[model samples]
Structures are given as C-alpha cells and as structure tokens.
Target: MGDRRLAIEAWESLFRAQHEVFGKLSGDFVGSDLSQAEYDVLLTVTRAPDMTARLRDVTANMLISQPSVSRLVDRMVGRGLVTKCSDPDDGRGALVTATEEGAHAFRVIGAAHGRSIAEHMACFDDEELRTLLTLTEKLRGYRSGE
Candidate 1:
C-alpha cells in the first residue's frame, strides 16, 4: 500500500508537470482570443480535403456530439470563418467549408500549432514517442460495449 501510494503520487506529479508545460505552451501559441474548441473546428475544416466537410462527418470525425458541433458551426459561420451549404447528395445534410479568410487564419494558426507540437516533442527521443503512441493505441482499442 505504501509503495502503491508513492507510485501514484509520483505519477500525478509528473502528469501535472507535463500538463502545466503543455497548457502554457499551447495556450500561448493558440493566442488568447480563440477558444480551444473554436480553433479545433477551424483547423479541422482548413485541413480537410477541399476545405469542406459534411456537418455530420465533422461531428463524427471530431468525436463531438451533433448538437454541439452545430452550435460551434453556427458561431463560426456568424464570424464569417466558414460557409454553409446544402450537401448536393442530401439536402437535409449541410456541408461546412472554410472561407478564404478562415483558410488564411488557419495557415497562421497551423504554423503556430506545428511549431508548438514540434517544440514539445523536441524533448522526446523517437523511440520514446513511438512507444508511447503504441501503448496508447493498444489501451484504446477496447470494444465499445466493454
């Protein structure tokens, strides 16, 4: 029990330290204005092929709820960061696309995000990162009902 407690405490300390460093770095690089969710939507739209994605597709790809995604899209469209169109195949389904301004904004934000991720990873050796990813994926593959 004593050893278990000690190990848990150590793990927590390391986790907090990493979080603090990453939070500060990502927050700075992402700027003070854009919320993380907003930036996520923007970047996802920008990086999508043809700068377009079906509304439900974005929600599924982002692992967010449909209503939440819709609200986010509404906000973004209001800001002129995206354009909404009816999906040609399904009129009921809307397509969200990045506007020119949004694409340009993404370019700026994307560069910053790239640099931030690169800087954070600079401390890790390739093997360490690869091992971390492998373990994470292994643990994440549980069946949905499990």
Candidate 2:
C-alpha cells in the first residue's frame, strides 16, 4: 500500500485545487440569466440528443439532491427556459427539453465560459492536461470500459 500520509496530502491538494478553480469559474454566471446550477443542467441537456435529457440523468450529473433538481426544473419551466414532461416510456421518469431561449442563453454563456476555462487551464501543457484528466478519471472510479 501507498503511504497513508502522502495519500491524505495528495487528496487535500486535489480538493483545494478544485475549490479554488470552481470559485474562479463561478464568476462566469454573474449578471447572467442562468445561475451556475441552471447552466449545469443545460450543459447536460444541450449535449443530449434533440437537446433533451432524462430528468434522472440530469440529476445524476448534478451535485444537488433529486428534489432540488426537480424544483430547479420547475423554475426553469416557469421562466420558459425548458419544458418538462412525463416520459412515455417510463411512468416514473420525466424528460426535459430546452426551449429556444434556453438554448440561446446556454450557447452565449457557454462560449464565454469555455474561453474562461481554457484561459484558466492554459497553465498546463497538453501532456500535463492529459495526465491530469486520466488521473482524475481514475480517482473518480471511471475505467475505460465496463
């Protein structure tokens, strides 16, 4: 086994780095129509086929509780950012589809956010970035294949 002290130190470093980076990126939503949570929801929705995704899937990808995700979706519906409906294939499931306005907002903020992420991540070279990606994925219990 690896040194326990070294493992804890590494984990602390990773946590601090993530906290600092997220704090910086949180500014991307300032004065915007979408909050960080909304953007996160749309991020998954917009990438899904037909700009739609399962509510469960969205919730799975989020850091918040399932009930919180439901409430957020309700609020988004009220704002006309997205439409939520029961999934015909599964009575217990719901589907969310982005409205045109939501898609437009996502695109706008997504562009700027992308640039900001690139700028922040530019400190790492291509090789280092790849290594970081692999290490993070491994730490998350993600493997190349099931």
Candidate 3:
C-alpha cells in the first residue's frame, strides 16, 4: 500500500484499540449505573446552564438516532434520572432536564469516567494529545468535505 494508505491503516488500528479499551472500561463501570450513551446524555444536561437541553441537542451529541434517543429518554424518565418537559421554544418538542438525583449521580459517574480517561491517556504528552486531536478533527471534517 502507499504511504497514505499505510497512515490511514495505522490510525484505524489505533482507533480500534482505543475503542476496545473504552468498551472494557465502560463495562467495568457498571457501578456507575450509566451506560456510555446515558453518561453522555447526562453530561450534556449537567453542562447546560439550566441542567436541561432540548431533545435534539442531546441526540446530536449521542451516538444514536432520534428513535433511540426517545427510547433512551423514556428509560431514563422511568428510572427517575431525568424529566421530560415541554420545550418553550417549540410546542411539539420535548426538553430533557436532569433531575436532582440525576445530577448527583452524574457527578459521581462523571468523576469516575474522568479518572478513567486520565489514567488511560496519561502516557501522551500534552502536545502529542493536542496534535492528535487536531489531526483527528481535521480528518473528520475533511471526510465531510467541510
């Protein structure tokens, strides 16, 4: 293969390896009582000023589709981890807000997740990490012809 193909292959290999590591860690974090996707949604809600976001906002940040988001939100609602509210901007759209319980749980879980990422990525120098981030962002955007 050409140099470009080799570079792409190398990147893909490393990405796959990292993904596997994350999968294992995620599984081990069952104590947190949050799936990786649920955690992402929680994070999004917690980071918002009102600890709430529109359904589409969370969907955009998640790895799932609209239907999947709806199902997941319903599950979360059932778990008392989140509440669905009517969106003020749109009568038909729903807003997702983390309940007080969800915020507390997310705090605990987010800390654990942060520690996990820190431990795993500790080997990379800050500059190396920044370069990798820049390269990946560039590649991601390039693939979309941005």
Model 3 — which ten-residue stretch has the worst lDDT? 137-146
> Which parts of model 1 are misplaced by more than 4 Å?
1-22, 29-33, 142-146
- What is the C-alpha local distance difference test score of each model? 0.78, 0.96, 0.85
Candidate 2, pairs of clashing residues: none
> Tens digit of lDDT per residue, candidate 1, span 1-146?
56998978977986897798768666754444456666677777777899998887778766578899899899989988899889999979998999887777777777777788878878889999988677556556733443
Candidate 2 lDDT by residue in tens digits, 1-146: 89999999999999999999999999999999899999999999999999999999999999999999999999999999999999999999999999999999999999999999999999999999999999999888896772
Candidate 3 local lDDT, 1-146, one digit each (tens): 56998899988997997788878678646866787788888988889878999998899888889899989999999999999989999998999999998888888888877888878788789998998788778867853556
Q: What lDDT score goes with residue 119 in model 1?
A: 83
Indicate whether candidate 1 or candidate 3 has the larger lDDT.
Answer: 3
The global Cα lDDT (0 to 1) of model 2 is: 0.96
| Model 3 RMSD in angstroms | 2.9
Q: Candidate 1 versus the native: TM-score? A: 0.71
User: In model 2, where is the ten-residue run with the lowest total lDDT?
Assistant: 137-146
Task: Name the lDDT value of residue 121 in candidate 1.
Answer: 79
Query: How close is each model in CA RMSD to the real structure?
Result: 4.6, 1.1, 2.9
Q: How should the candidates be ordered by lDDT, best one leading?
A: 2, 3, 1
Best by lDDT: 2
Q: What does candidate 2 score in Cα RMSD to the true structure?
A: 1.1
Clashes of each: 0, 0, 0
Which portions of model 3 show Cα errors greater than 4 Å? 1-4, 142-146
